[model samples]
Target: MLNIKYDIVGSFLRPSQIKTARAQYANGEISLAELRAVEDEAISDLVEKEAAHGLKFVTDGEFRRRWWHLDWLKEFDGFTTEHLDIERGGVINHIELGYITGKIFYDPDRSHPEIEAYDFLHKEAGKYPGITAKKCISGPNMILVDNYLQLGIKEVPYYGSDVEGLIEDIAIAYQNAIKDLYAHGCRYLQIDDTSWTYMIDEKFLQKVASLGYKKEEVLDWFQRVSTKALEGRPEDMVIATHFCKGNFKGNPLFSGFYDTVAPIISRIPYDGFFVEYDDERSGSFEPWAVLKGSDATFVAGLISTKNPELESLEDLKRRYAEAKAVVGDNIALSPQCGFASVEEGNCIDEETQWKKIDLLVSCKDFI
Candidate 1:
């Protein structure tokens, strides 16, 4: 079980400096090195603030990239982003999609930008004692779910109709990536995934059927890919998964409960699970009863990052009690999701964001 009782879902709201620097880089007003200097300063300050706030871990705030998942996904071989001419209405229409042009593989000899980012975070975090620099990456299932299941990019000559083969290759690529990260001194890794929640969404279920795939089969594939990715993971490395309904611009893309995915959640080989429960859309805590006696830590995301209004202390304790009744003593607390899953961020202001973080830290006293 993870010794820490309070945690964060990783990404913090991007500061104005980063936003301006990125835009300058895009418009050719600033060089890439100049933009990186701004990001470096921002991240260094972020690590100091996180440590001062009493957080056990710190991230680079994902400041280097635009979209959380796409930035990391595009780094892998055979995966590239493309603009689609066809417009699918709803949340899918807002974002860029990825395409698999060849077999997915991770060449260890090549330099990875994420590794370089992690190296900087690890160094800054080392300045403060007892602080671990945690790295957050998109889960393996994200690529398949977003590209194939949602966007219907089903035709890939390499895997051609062999869905299981595709999943295996993705798993292998992720396994190699995890090994590489461990080598880079990343002991705490969080897989930020929105796909698990999609499995329970009604609209997403309809889309699954429309794609000629059964809901159960897709769940199994998600589980398989996730499990295979962690094969032979180091014992000292702590791997956790954060599951939230899409978090884009203070809005959720899908709505559902954890009831349907509880069994699959129990089956995944993660050391912990950070589940969204900040509002009515998450449903009841009864589903977590499936994990009552397990050693894995169940992080109840009882605070809301989307809303600025602070959660009442009494109400937070009450809800924590409700979760404790079902999931036993192994539990932690965090905001439902990151302050910014994308570069746009949630609706809350930075002052309010830190206040929420203060509340998160305070809640740990009772736990």
Candidate 2:
């Protein structure tokens, strides 16, 4: 069984030096090797810090990439990254979205760069005996929403309106990727996903309707695609899914209770779920009742990551109490999302970020 008490949702605030190195590399002022050297140093320090804090699992802080999803997708075949202005939380933000260009395939050799990333994490984590290295990758649902759905059926003629075929290919590619990660000695993997949260938004539903699709039909597609992707993962591998409601700047993309998606989400085969429960925007814990009798654990994100304000311990306990009342005792604690979902990081200082994690750890046994 996974013995996770207090865990992180991956992605920590990027250090200033690492951010500078990335900017310098992007502007051609520094070589890729120089940038990677700086990243390695930063990630090493971050891992040591998390291990020292007693976190059982640690990430590389996603220091080597910009957006969490695009960075992983760029490694796959048939996906190309492009800059676009996306509106999030009523503001326009320039971000990279991976577009589908040709047939999709997850080439292990091409994915070795990340496998090596995990190698570094595993090596660093080795310095702390009790902790394990965890690698977070974007889920197949991202590909469905960003490339296939957003691009439309006509634009990516390779897919040719064959939604089922598209889902199958994505799932197969993901399965191959998962097996490769396990081969590289990665035992803990979290598939970070945000597309599923959009199902609760009326505007998103209207958009789907305009495309001749029903919301339930699209959700059903996500379920099948997500499940198929987990098909051949090793039984020993601890897999978790994080449901993000979009973290950009300090704002959210969509918000609603988990009511709409719970029936479908409850059936996901992941060992645990890291769910967003930070603010009023995320709605109530009532929907999580569906997981009451299942083996799945709910890592309730009762703390916020978008800002620096530390959540009070009493309030945190109260939130867990409410969720536990619905889902029983298979509960865990984490921030609503990653401290930094992108390179910019959240509008919080490093000291404050650690304090938030300290709070989570202190409250591990509260539920």
Best by lDDT: 1
What are the clashing pairs of model 2? none
TM-score of each: 0.96, 0.95
lDDT of 1: 0.89
Poorest 10 consecutive residues by lDDT, candidate 2:
148-157
In terms of lDDT, model 2 sits at 0.84
Residues 177-275 of candidate 2: C-alpha lDDT, one tens digit per residue: 999999889899999988888888777777778887788888998999999999988999999999878887556777667788888977879988899
Q: Which parts of model 2 are misplaced by more than 4 Å?
A: 86-92, 153-157, 365-367
RMSD per candidate (Å) reads: 1.8, 1.7
lDDT by residue for model 1 (17-70), tens: 999999999999999899999999999999999999889888998989788898
